[model samples]
Target chain A: MRELLRVAPGGAVDLGAVDPRSTPGLPGREVTGPQRKEWARGQLTLIGAELGRQQEMLFAEAKARQSAARPVGAAAGGGGSDAAAGGAGGRRVLLVLQAMDSGGKDGTVKRVAGAMNPLGLHVRSFGPPTPEELRHDFLWRIRRALPPPGYVGVFNRSHYEDVLVARVESLVPESIWQARYDEINAFEREQADAGVALVKVFLHISYAEQGRRLLERLDEPRKHWKYDPSDVDARARWDDYQAAYAEALGRCGTDAAPWYVVPADRKWYRDWAVAHLLRETFDTLDLGYPPAGFDVRRERERLLGSERTA
Target chain B: MRELLRVAPGGAVDLGAVDPRSTPGLPGREVTGPQRKEWARGQLTLIGAELGRQQEMLFAEAKARQSAARPVGAAAGGGGSDAAAGGAGGRRVLLVLQAMDSGGKDGTVKRVAGAMNPLGLHVRSFGPPTPEELRHDFLWRIRRALPPPGYVGVFNRSHYEDVLVARVESLVPESIWQARYDEINAFEREQADAGVALVKVFLHISYAEQGRRLLERLDEPRKHWKYDPSDVDARARWDDYQAAYAEALGRCGTDAAPWYVVPADRKWYRDWAVAHLLRETFDTLDLGYPPAGFDVRRERERLLGSERTA
Candidate 1:
């Protein structure tokens, strides 16, 4: 499944070659049309329920570890650099999503990641940088938004914009934006060392599809709020954006921080693929309920005994 | 519904008088037994979906308003006190849940709030305050975790802990904990003035039910992770905690932040009631999608025209 979507480290990606409408095969064979959509929905429902348990397991592990790290009578809440992270530390996962307008970044999150316990999930969307953000390094705000340990963080749009949109719109000078590819690489490397697993996804949608989506938003009174005129301006430079995306995806795709170009013309397939990829990531991590720090046998006696006392 | 559950301002609360197993009336009359559970489940599912839409509407409006508030060429991201809040502002909501151990707070979040978009929902669980957190006012950390506008925030445990556990366990001096009821009311009033709505809920359960839950946890290996020894200690003093809760609920039940005593003996009823309450909250807000900031007709032309150019 990953082989179809994942770009290898140092791999050259040609955005034009990949079919935006292509749906990857599920386990045994490719399920198509209505059946495929139904299969994906069923799988998503199951996956969502499992993800909820997985998150709680990780959270329990974090709490146990945090308690262990704290000195007795020193008071709860793990201290040190981790103090800022609300006494949580352990394995973390981040999902970075980049897409052209109406490429279903929001849809992917709502469908694929929505069912997970929000306590263990953090979703940060990056649009145009604020003036304060501009004053700092490109990765500054991204750093601030990174998920604390034992969390699954999703970025609707991310630092890739420093290279993609920055290059396409010439928001920053050529030299500065060009240097950012390596800066992002180094930044991601640090996160990886810090026990953060990265899943960078590009929801690949066609130009015509984006235009159709934009038009639909404009026509539907309920969706009018989502229709931005600037989206059209970006649509007009579709070729430039595509070129910029190809370069960014090609340059930033790494073993530690891989990029998956999910064909998003079909929203169902896009959602399924992302969920599948995320489940695969969790499968690799040794995630399960952490053992109780206290003696369970002793606790059981105390718990049952307290009933008599009450 | 509010009349049945709400603890009116300055009202006397007798925790012993209310039946933990009671289910409130629906619109007209109450549904009972299995049928009631099924009905609540169906209602919860429908309410969850609608809440998702309402949250998106509020988010859309917040974005629109934030952009409008910024000066031209301001380079997006609303600046000011709002800058730290991800540029989101509008109607905010806080749902604070309190209960004895095994009161099904986590279960309610899973069954009710699970369907909402994680991007717009923030859930914070307050355990024992950290050394640093204890150094400041009890409300400091609570204030930090308050949901920004356009977001629904859930607190698994909250400031009520100051009066409940602090008084029950004598963790703080009597004078300090006694004064917190007014302090909490003032804090919630400030939040109300800042366009925040508060729904403080106590998941009331019978002592026998809690014992049954604890024994189940003890018996099941998978559930052992959650069986803490301290929970038994807390359970031993159940009556004291109840008294503390009764006092806090009576005093802090302001016009702005009403406290609801949710009968949580039936897990299904507890989830259904909370979801219903949240839906009623959203219903009161003008939560349809915000109107487009730009000319929709002109954008529609530009969107259609882009297809030709592409």
Candidate 2:
């Protein structure tokens, strides 16, 4: 599933070549309609539970590493082998989601990222740059929001906007936007070295599906706030945006930070795929609870008795 | 349920007077054991859905208020009546959780606030103050983490810790900690005036329960990382913490930010109470999607046809 969705590093990405409705890794695609949706949801719940457990281990490992800095190890020589320094190493995950309006970025996060404890998760949504943000380099705010050593950070519409929107809308000069491709790869490599495993996702939806979603936003009273007039303006230039995305995905894909193009037209498949990818990412982390930072026997005795430490 | 759980503003609190195991607002206390736990979990799922919907509406309302600043209302007079101006107003909710170790603060958040969209949610956990944080006023970091116009912010451990831990540990002089009660009230009031509705929850657990939980952390290899040796030290001073929390709850509870004492010995009840409180808080926000910012007829036409505005 991970291999199917991952954009090969330095490979040409033609958005038109892949079908947005494809459920690539789904078992036995013979089961269509409601049954498929049901299967995806069931799998998502199990995947989500796995994601949650991994995130807790990530947090627990950090806490162990941090508190291990205090008393026990130096004086008492900490009980077990890993007790002095903690079991798991410091490795963080950053998931970046980019898509067109109504492409289901919000929905995917609600279903996939939502499974993890909010404590170990930091979800940052970057809208168009504010006046102050515009003054700084585009990566300034992006860098500030990066997850710390133990967290799973999510950027909903991230720095890729610098290339995607800038190129599609001519927000910057040709020379500048074109140069960002290399700049982004370099920045991502640095993050990877710093223990940030980047999972960049593009929610791929067909043009027809986008129109349907936009119309639904207009039709439903509860969804009216989601329908911006400018969305239509953006839709008018859909081909330009697609070309920009294809170029950006092809150019920026790297071993350090690869892009995953999820078939977002089927919300069920999209949610399941992202959750599965996250589970796969964290599964490789070798995560586990640290050994006791203190002597287990001593602490147990201390807890049982209301007295001074041994 | 809100009234049952809320500690009255300026009222004295005696921790010993309340039973930590008592399930308030769970219909028919006669139904004991797993059935009651089962009922609470079922209610939680329903309440969580409501919470999720309200949170989305809160985010939508903010988006409308922001974009309502541009175009629409001022030009072409938007569409019809109320079309220029958004219907829903700006209101943010802040949930603060405080507890002794093993009081289920993390569990409650995973069960309850976990239901909301993480996009509109900002979960900030405040640990022991850093050296730089100590130089500033205690409320300094609290203010920095406050929810913005649209977000629903959460504080895993908040400024109340200044009173709880500082008083219990004697980290600050009696004079300093004594004066902080009013300082907290004033700060919270200011936040209330600025569109933040504070929902303070203290997950109340018995000393015996804490001991049981600590032992479980030691017994389970997967949970060893959660057990810090100092937690036993904290447990030794259980009475002092209870007194400190009692005083803080009484003094800090106000109409603007009331303290809810959730009997957290029962995990299901604690999760249900907090989720119920959040639903009731946002239920009063009168949340809804804003009126159409642009002419719906024109936008529909634009979406159907790939062309310029009408």
Candidate 3:
């Protein structure tokens, strides 16, 4: 039953075809076809099931911890311990995106990132840079939203837009925006070296998909508020945006911060793929309880007695 | 250092003065001194750093369980499985307030409730109830937001307002609103009998405290967006609202959903007290991991390989 539910109709897309070198602007090109295919097929079920299992286990564990009744600081190392030492010694993740209206950013954040601990996860949606943000560098606002140690921070639409959308629409001079790709690569490299796991996903959907979603939003009364007519103008720049994405992905697709060209034509597959990738990233972390040997009984008893007295 | 932090100046209020036998409409003779003091102390530390430690532990446990990579059905019995099995076995805490405009609901939620899994924790902030909500019953919206099974659900403000604010402000007739106390008591008794842990905290603050907060909002540019002059009308009826709270708390104070009048004069103290109460409630659960003896390795290997052939 689980197997049947897990396997989607289209199956996993070829990651190599979506690779940067294969096809610059076009969507389809297969490199390392057989090997990548075999690898993806071999790992898909195990990875999916493992992700689901982890989510459930995490929920159960959180519930149990709530019931332990231990003094808060006692169970999680000593008081004043940094979060990193309290069993969350993992590479922090930061997700950056540059999406047009009805570009599925909200859905991506919810479906891809919803299961994460709200405490350890930060979602910052950058509307527009402030005057202060513009005074320094464009990356300043983005820098402020970076996740702390052992946390994941997601940007709904990110600094890439200073090059992508701004370039496409001539929002900034070509000279000013063109240099950002290298600057971005350097900035991401710094974060990677600083123990931040970066997985940049571009929800590569066709103009047709964007149109269908926009229409659906209009049809659904609940989503009607989200519809904007100006999105049509953005849609007209489809080729320009596609070229920009290809260039950005090509320039910034380092071993440190690889870009995944997600086939977001299928929302379920996109969600599953993102979840699988996140699980893989977190699995690489060596998170566990601190080595136990602390005597918390005295503190616990004292606190309880104080409670009773109060 | 921990002891000094724990024993900081604030302590729970005395509730001894509360008389269970007291009839409704009695002026301000609500809570007994001891109970009031205990309640006060509990609220003071609801979101203190101590509580933050507990939250971190819960998340850490969840992360560990997830990392172990067990099967979903069986993994539910992993670390902290006791909470899953307990299934609504502890006290149901409900926090009530007038308006959370800037009354620290988000801060409280993050500090006190951020640690628990979303599955076992729920928050429902009642804005103007939908037409559908009002059409059914006053308690309809409130009941819908109650925590399921073994979990905690916090109400920014609660059903008491239908009587307190609506009565004092003449939003509803006195005869109609007055009868809600018995209805609420009966409802709470039903929850208590079913092992629902019920805690009601009225975050009390003087008009001066509120005025100071409002002034801060106006002074700070970032917070300017949050201020609403409409709050002055609510502040004008401060004395009337207090009388209503005193009456309602006195009448509805039961073993099931006991009202704890917390002093919100100090934000730190309130956060600490809430966390303390929550910790106390969960400690009573005696939760632990379920018995585990399942072979997951074989299944994992099989699943990993099956996708290749498909």
Candidate 4:
């Protein structure tokens, strides 16, 4: 299941060759058409429930651990640092998603990730850099947004934009964007080392599919507000964008945090695949309900024998 | 419904006199026994669903507004200041819960507030301040935890602690805790002026209930982790604690952020009351789905003319 979508470390990736309509095999065989869509939807529902429960277990465990570890006189407000309150330092997941405009990043978060416990999930969509952000290192803001332990942090568009959009759009010098590839791989490796399970997903969609979606946003009354005229200009540079993405996937894919090019042409499939990938990520972790640590008989006696009673 | 539990601004409140077991009338006459518990449970379920949907509307509207208002080239990471991204400045909810040990603050959050979308909800359980925090005024940390627009922020235990625990425990001198009542009122008024719907709840549990719950924690192995030996010491000082709470509630309760003394002996009733109070708070606000704001005809033509399509 993990291997089906993973781009092996340093594996060469050609965006032009990988079909945007391809749906990876689930367990045994390849699923397609209506049957595949139905199967994916069912899997999504089941996985959504599982993700919710898993999050609860992690939260409870973290809360208990935090209670046990809090220093004396520490305030009881739930404003402690994420690492302290969340507990189990390395037990977190960061789903780094990179895709072109109209590639379903927002839709995937809304339809799939939205079903999970929002307390345990942090979905961050990156856009253009602010003046302050440009003044610092690119990864500074990314560091601030990393999911706290026991959480699943989704980066709607991640640091890869430094090498992809920055390269294709000439936002920075060639010397800078070209060097970002190494910096990104190292940064992700450090995250993986820290026990943050990194799942980098490239939502793969065709040129025509993007155009259609952009037009749909324009045509639909409710969605018109979401359509941006600037999106068309980006679409005009589609081939160049593809080449930039191809280089990124090939250069940055690593064993610690492999890139998965999910088919974004089909919304159902794309959502299901992303959800499935997330569930599998959780499956690999040692997550469960924490042990009960108090003396049951003595406490029950105390409750029953309390001098002052409700 | 709003009138049922609200403590009129500056109203005299005697903690010793307010029955912890008093159940306010929901609509009609008071209900009793098993029927009352069942009734509260039903309301809890219904209100939970409404809060969830209302949150979605706010989130969608905020997301749209943010996109429209984002300064070009804003940083792409998720760590931007909340005020900037969650536009409309004052469209947010902050529920502040202050209670004695085992007062069901955690339970109320889990059973009622937990049902809302976590994405739009910010739960901050304020603990003792860190050394750095102690250097600043008490309101410093409280201000840091205020939720941005389009979100519901819950302060498990709040600034009132400065007057409540700090007063009873004598952690601070009379000179300090004495002035906090006015400071607290001013801060809450500022929040209300900023458009934050503030509801302060004092989960009024009987002394006996606290003993029973404390013992339950000690007795139950799973809950043993939550039992603090110091809790018994606080229980011993119940009378002093109550006086502090009564004064805090009476003095700080204002038109902008009235305090509600909820009879919390019955877990079912407590959960329902908090959920109901939150729903009413939101009810007073003009929250709804934002209107669609894009060109329909132009977009429709673009979609029809796209050569490559989904």
Best by DockQ: 1
- Candidate with the greatest lDDT versus the true structure: 2
lDDT per residue (tens digit) for residues A50-138 in model 1: 77777777666666677666555443211111213542436788999888888998888888779687767777777677778888988
TM-score, every prediction:
0.93, 0.92, 0.44, 0.83
lDDT, residue B126, candidate 4: 62
Clashes of 1: 0
Residue B68 lDDT in model 3? 40
* Higher-ranked by DockQ: 2 or 4: 2
Q: Residues A244-273, candidate 4, lDDT per residue (tens digit)? A: 887888888888888888878988888888
- Distance from true location, Cα of A175 in model 3, Å: 1.8
Docking class of 1: acceptable
lDDT of 2 by residue, A1-310 (tens): 7798999878559889889998888986576777999988998999888898888888776777667655542312111112112123467899999988889888887888888887678888876666577898889888877776678888888889899777877788999998899999999998898778889999999899999999998888888987778777778788888998998999998988989999999999999999988888887788887787768998888888863343
Error of 2 at A123 (Å): 0.7
Q: Which residue pairs show collisions in model 1?
A: none
> Evaluated on chain B only, what are the TM-scores of all the candidate structures, in order?
0.92, 0.91, 0.66, 0.91
Poorest 10 consecutive residues of model 3 chain B by lDDT? B1-10
What does the lDDT come to for candidate 1? 0.78
TM-score of 4: 0.83
Per-residue lDDT for B261-300 in model 4, tens only?
A: 8989989878888988888887888577666544567645
